[model samples]
Target: MKKILYLLLLVSIMTSCGEYNKILKSTDYEAKYEYAKNAFEKKKYTQAYTLLEELVTIFKGTDKAEESLYLLARSHYLNKDYETSGQYFTHYYTHYPKGQYTELARFYAGYGYYLNSPEAKLDQSGTYKAIDEMQRFLDYFPHSERAKEAQDVIFELQDKLVYKELLNSQLYYNLGNYMGNNYQSAVITAQNAIKEYPYSKYKEALSMIILKAKFQEASQSVYEKKADRFRDVIDEYYSFINDYPDGPNAKEAKDIFRVANKYVKE
Candidate 1:
């Protein structure tokens, strides 16, 4: 019985494939549209995308245009072709501002970028684009059911930007006074990151970097600049502790402060 069932399933699949191929070659737009919908429903996104791609322009300005365009975007999204999906979604919203799928198009256009955002080590243009899209979604649909999710994604993307800056700052710190004053560069980078992402989870780490960078900068300065630079390090250490009394780097910060205090007179 199982063998017979399997044979029947194989025959059904072959017949379905044959019919789909026939439909693909036909000029019958209505038939193609119906088949595309069915293919999408069956999760055959590649087939659906192929069929919809042909019909979207044909159905333009027709009653089927809105749904056809939206389906084209969704098919790409379902296929995990997020970049392509984002483009289609943007097209849909731009053309059909008040269409039935406008909300979804706006949300997914940005959400697709978020889904495709690369790691912190990689270029983060996609992450920034995602944040822009999601922020626009919030501005347009503040009460949308997906608003909170969009907001959360924005926060996550911002964190990624902060982390990238953190890595840059650390690199500068590691370079130290290799050829020039890299510690100054590290302090500037960390301070900018702290200002840009005041609520970032990396806030403490950035502050710590600033303090350490200042100490190193002072330590390596010429005798004429050492006392004033060390005093700057002491001020940075106090500000770091004020913000995070029990911070993970408290011990290190305090030790640096103790050393810096020895250089600057009361």
Candidate 2:
């Protein structure tokens, strides 16, 4: 009985493949499209897109063009080809402003990139693209059902950029003044991140870095500049504490302030 069941299953697989091949060879584009749509419904993404690739162009200017293009993009998205998905989705909305799938395409075009956004230490071009796409989606569909989700994603991606800047700032601080004024670089980077993403969760981390960098820069300054630089450090500590009066880094910040205040006094 098991052997009989196995034979039936094998036959079913072969017959299915044979039918798909027959459809592939047929010139009946409508039949091919029907089969692709069915294939997609059955989760045969590769087979779905294999036919969709040609049909999208063939159906251009026809009633089916909008749907076929959108399906092609969605197929790529399900297959985890985010890069290709993003391109096709962009194309879909660009060509069909009021098309049935325009809103969905716009949403996924950016969301897919957000899903593929790289780590903070890596290149952030994709993250930037994701932010741009999500922003565009919000601008065009402010009242969409997906509007809240898109807005949240935009904030998350922005935070990723902030995290990247935080890492850069930390790197500069670590380098100290090896061959240049890296502490100053660290301060500049962190400050710019704060200015751009004032509401980011990393604002506290960035502020801490700025305060630390300022202290380091002042502590290492030449004798004549020490008094003036420490005064600057005192100013930064006050600013950091004012913003994060009870933040996690408060203890360290106050320690720095004590040293800075005492130095300026002497």
lDDT of each: 0.94, 0.95
Q: What's the TM-score of every candidate structure? A: 0.96, 0.97
- Superposed on all Cα atoms, model 1 deviates from the true structure by an RMSD in Å of 1.4
lDDT for each residue of candidate 1 in 174-219, tens digit (9 for 90 to 100): 9988998898899899889989889999999999989998898888
Candidate 2, pairs of clashing residues: none
lDDT of residue 252 for candidate 2: 100
Which consecutive 10 residues in model 2 have the weakest lDDT in total?
Answer: 57-66
Residue 228 error for model 2, in Å?
0.6
* TM accuracy, model 1: 0.96
Which candidate leads in lDDT?
2
Per-residue error (Å), model 2, residue 215? 0.6
Q: Which runs of model 2 end up more than 4 angstroms from their true locations?
A: 1-3
lDDT of 2 by residue, 25-55 (tens): 8889999999999999999999999999989
